[model samples]
Target chain A: MPSLLILMPLAGIMILNFAFGRTMKRSAFWFAVVLFLIQIILAIFHHPVFWSNELEMVDRFFNVSFSMDYISFIALLSIGIVSLVSLLVARCSIDNEEDRFNFINLLVIASIGMSGIVMVKDVFSLYVFLEITAAASFILIAFWRKRRALEGAFKYILLSAIATIMMLTAIALLIVLAGDPSFSVIKSALGRSSSSFMVTLAVGIFICGLFIKGGLVPFHGWLPDAYSSAPAPVAILLAGIVTKVVGIYTIMRVMISLFGFSASMGRVFMFIGALSILVGAFAALGQRDFKRMLAYSSISQIGYILLGFGTGTTIGILGAVFHFFNHAIFKSLLFVNSAAVEDSVGTTDMDKMGGLASRMPITGATSVIALLSACGIPPLAGFWSKLIIILALWKSGHVAYTLIAVFASVLTLAYLLSMQRRTFFGKLADGLEDIKEAHTRIRVASIILAAITVLVGVFFPLMFDNFILPVKDILLR
Target chain B: MNELYWRIFLNFSFFIIMLFIAGFYCILVTRNLIRVMIGLELLIKAVTLFLVVACYVSGQAALGQALIITLIVMEVVMIAVLAGVVLSIYRHNNSLDARRLRELKG
Candidate 1:
């Protein structure tokens, strides 16, 4: 039944299209919502039926040998939560039920790909799932078929195809050296031939592809364009989980599982992290488009997760994992608020928005919660994760980097607060006096996400023990 | 068997590098979106040949074939989607020049 996590979604997609009518069309939204909820609950409870492999009869039939661990749990839970939030935004912002139905179907497909990504145990299988996710995302990003979306989609296609080629080329090289594609097999094989020129070349190319996929500073050309031009819900999904799963999560898994993190790799990771932080923060400061600014902020925050991970300690890894999840939740919350603003005000230009807090109280309040957490304000989830990362850096004697990371937070706070000031705090804009609140589903989505942020922040110790502590087992691998 | 891999790799290395360079040149120097797609196709073609030769020499023809087949299918899907986007862009702007795609600047 472990494969059911992936198989069931595929089956759902097939069955969803078989008897297409008004009921199936309308039920698509609720069906995906319930499926994501079930995914979240199973991940939370760590259900023995799926994780324990008791159903050998069914498992043998599939021959996939999917496994779940604490790291996968974190990834899977974030996938479910972000997909659910994306669906909520889609339902509210997309007035056409037909479009909603199509959007939900693609969303389910993307989640299946992400689930496969988290569960698979081989390099080749990992590539397959990554393509599945990317293909689904390309279609989703260009769903509106407008000029900006199309332009963004084309650039993404060229860049993503190049990344795929790079990764596949590396895999081919590894296959020639290592006889099998499994993580354990390749790790042992590559470990024996660690210092050869070909091996280093292969590893470097693969990581460069991942840097592009992750939208780090050097390879981030297509990211902001894709995020800002994609329809609102797609922005949430892309910024929240798609790029993260396709890029950052893959880097973490491949480095830890296949190529163990050595000091050299740690140095590379930290260098890239510092560059992305400086570039993303400064670029975000100049953005006037609401979604584009958030997209740049996404890059900056991703840099923090990389910095945490580069520390190469248990506390650092734990902090990275926690920050990954928090980024997904709060960033999606911010995007959902932007969707609400778009639905109500019909635009996302910050310069054109003023005093929206009075018009859309729920979105405004939730956005405040999300932004404070993003800025690492005290008693917020982001603060604790940042604290862990900075402490790890200091402990590891990277005091210069620690100072740089801390100062970057002030930059993060300044741009985000300026965005808030321009969009929500001033006197009402000319044409927005009659604006009403967003759709009810949107309000509820933001409230739930905000509540999670507050609760996770307030109960930091509880979350640390129950959800994040087990991530240390990954390092032991 | 390892000698066979090295022999085959040495024979094909120059050709693959040429293809790689040509593909990059095409992609970098092109102004037309269609030419960009063609360049990407060339790049994928180069990789596919490399994968095929690598699998042939590694004695893991089964895994190599499976990967290339999947790679081909994924490429077709990607090219189709990208072409559709290009078509839509043409419909909107009546030109396929890369310069026309400047609507998303800072």
Candidate 2:
């Protein structure tokens, strides 16, 4: 029942995309909303699947299987919520008629692909879904067809192609060494195999591929351009869910499910996560553009989550999950606020605006909330998640990493405050007194997200105990 | 004790490696987008050859090889379409150097 609640909307959206009709656009948006509401009901009520074991369906030569646990279930809910918010944001931001349809349809397909990635048990199945998501994202990025949009889309395609090839080659090597593509088979093979060289090579290649997709440090060249140039609604989905599911989630699955979370692998993840944290934070401090600074800050926040998960301890895993949820909410809120700023004032350059709070009150207040949330202020979601991660790092006795994590959080706040001060405070900018606030739908979505950010912070214990703790146990085991 | 088989395997691996390296070099150094596309095609071909060799070494059936060959054909068609698109871009901008095409940045 729960799976259907998630999968049916995906199927409906795919059909709606190609069906030529006058009412397709409105129908698709409402259909997507219906899907999200159903997912919400399922999440709140907690329906249990009848079958205790894994469910597999054999279609032609492919085996598509799904196994549900707390992590995937939470992931499904997050994707649903974010997709709905993005839809609402899009409905407000997009002006053209044709673009509205394409944007919403691509979003539906991308959400389906993301959900499929979380649900699928097979590596090849995951690859197929990832391809769907990546392809949809490529089209969406180039949806604008402006010169910058085209270049960003092209670079995204090229880099994604490179990463996919690396991953495929690594999968081929694993098949050669393990003789099977199943996660369980590969995991056991890596454990029992005497050829350390082959195992190391395979792991190295796979990690490289994952990191490129994950946008960690040096492999993050394509991220800022893609995030900054794409439409803000699409950017919300991309920055919020796409990177988390395809990149970070894959790393977690590979490490915990396929590689047994080895100490050496943990060390490697920690190093990369630390590098991403410092590099992303320091890079963000220098950005003058609102969206680009947010993009860099996201990279830094993702680093925190990755660092927590890399510790290979239960506390660490819990921190990582918390950080993931926090980052998603605040980042999407920030992106939407950026969209609102762009809509009202017609610019994303922070230097051009001295003050906007007087002109766009709702946008101003919500942007402030999101900025504080992102900066990890106490009583906001980001703060608790950041605290949990630092505690986890300290508990794991990684003193150096813990310090770096705290430093990165401070840096995140500093840049976010700078952006806020430039855009929301002081006198109104020249020729901007008449700029209006965002449309109704946009304000509603941002307000809901800001409220969630605060609610999640206050209810951290419930979040950790119910959702994150179970997932941590599963990953650490 | 099969010296002939050893000689054949080593010669095959050497040829495959050379093909792959040449294709990779072209992809890395080529300035023209069309030449780079050709290089990518060559690289795929070389990888297919290597995959076929691995299958032979592992005593697998011809299914993997057959699948790869079909993929190569599909890749060729896709590349042809992409080449047309790239050609249009080049004609519109009057250049083929990828480095010069930086109208997009943060």
Candidate 3:
């Protein structure tokens, strides 16, 4: 019964690919909506008693089990929401029947992989699921079969392959040391055993692999291209949740639960996080393409999330996880807005667009809301998370980083507002007289996301109490 | 007796690591897409061998073998898909040169 959460998506993929491939041409979108809704309902209501019972009988029957901690619960919920939103976005953007079929199939499979990653108890299974997700993403990014798409996918595959090799080596070393690959066994083993050169080396390699996956500054070569060239819905999914789940969340879980955070590790995370923030924000300022700027902005926002985790405080981790949820909402909304703009205007180039708000009011309004939320304006969700992170940093005596983070938030606002001014607020550019609002389906998705951002911001205390605090308690326990 | 066995295991592990490094070098230096794929395959083989050796040394050969089979299956699927993608790239550009596929820039 517990396994159904993962299996249902796999089943969806098989059914969509073969069983209904011929009959379900236009109805595929609705079919996927129902499928995702079922999965989300199951995830929310299907918490097994044995997960919290601590019974050996349960362990014997399921040697490999899903964790039912707050971390996994929140991750699962967010994955469900993002996958549903991405599916909706895809409904409007993807027109070709064959392409749509493949997209839904791959997205379902990728969702399974993501669900497995967060829920699984063992490191080996995590690696397997990570690979599954990576493989699916490569195809999704290159689905258009365009030259640029292929190039993006190829770069992603190459970089991801190298990261996989590193991770595999790390896993092999870890298995030898622990005599098993499960998280509990490895944690206990490391606790009993003293840190040695080999252990340190393995941990370093593992973290490096995750950093590349997460698109931290030095290993982020493929990120901009992959995010920019991917179909807009795919970009929304990638920027919104894929990197967060596969990259950032894994790093947090391993570093906190397995290695146990040390001061040196904290310093390393902060330095890297600061570098990514500055570099990503500054580079975003120079982008001509709209999606590319958002891609860079994603890297910058991710830096904030990492920096919060680096503080290793309860409030810090809370802020980080909350920001993770917030980033998923706003970033995906922004990407969808970019898609709406591109679809209506036929290009993502910022210089070629102007004064579109008068025409595409829904897209323009939602984009403004998403951008403001992203830039940490007060009365919005991003502001509260950023405030918490800064407070955590200041409390932890990282005065310099706090200032830098604050400064980078300004940089974020500068680029985003400038982007808004160029694309929507200025005088209408020539040849855009016929531009219309994005498809109703696309508009609905953006509206749903924008509403969540506003509602979460307005009701942040309730959100923090009900959602973020549980995750923080688990992490800092 | 156990010390001698341990020494042999350590020596073999070192050799495998060296082979892995060599494969990594091949990937870094090669410009041809096919050669890079070959390099990737070599790396997978080296990792597979290492997993087997680790399992043998730890007396968990059965579990290790099961894992290795799964790993090999995944590796084969990955390489096959990668090869198809590379072929598509070649067909489109009329060259397998990695340098020529540089349309995206920032």
DockQ of each: 0.84, 0.30, 0.68
lDDT string for model 2 (A148-211, tens) is: 6656666676677567656665665665566565787878888888778868887898889888
Q: Spell out the clash pairs found in candidate 3.
A: none
Native RMSD of candidate 3 (Å): 2.3
Q: Which lDDT values do the candidates have, in the order given?
A: 0.89, 0.77, 0.85
What docking grade does candidate 3 earn?
medium
Q: After superposition, how far is residue B1 of candidate 3 from its true place, in Å?
A: 12
Model 3 lDDT vs. the true structure?
Answer: 0.85
RMSD of each: 1.2, 3.3, 2.3
Error in Å for residue A466 of model 1: 1.2
Q: What fraction of the reference structure's interface contacts does model 1 contain?
A: 0.79
Error of 1 at A393 (Å): 0.6
Instruction: Specify the CAPRI tier of model 1.
Output: high
- Model 1, position A369, has a per-residue lDDT of 94
Task: List the pairs of residues colliding in candidate 1.
Answer: none
How far off is residue A401 in model 1, in Å? Answer: 0.9
Runs off by more than 4 Å, candidate 2:
A1-10, A17-20, A43-46, A50-63, B1-20, B43-94, B104-106
- Per candidate, native contacts kept equal 0.79, 0.13, 0.43
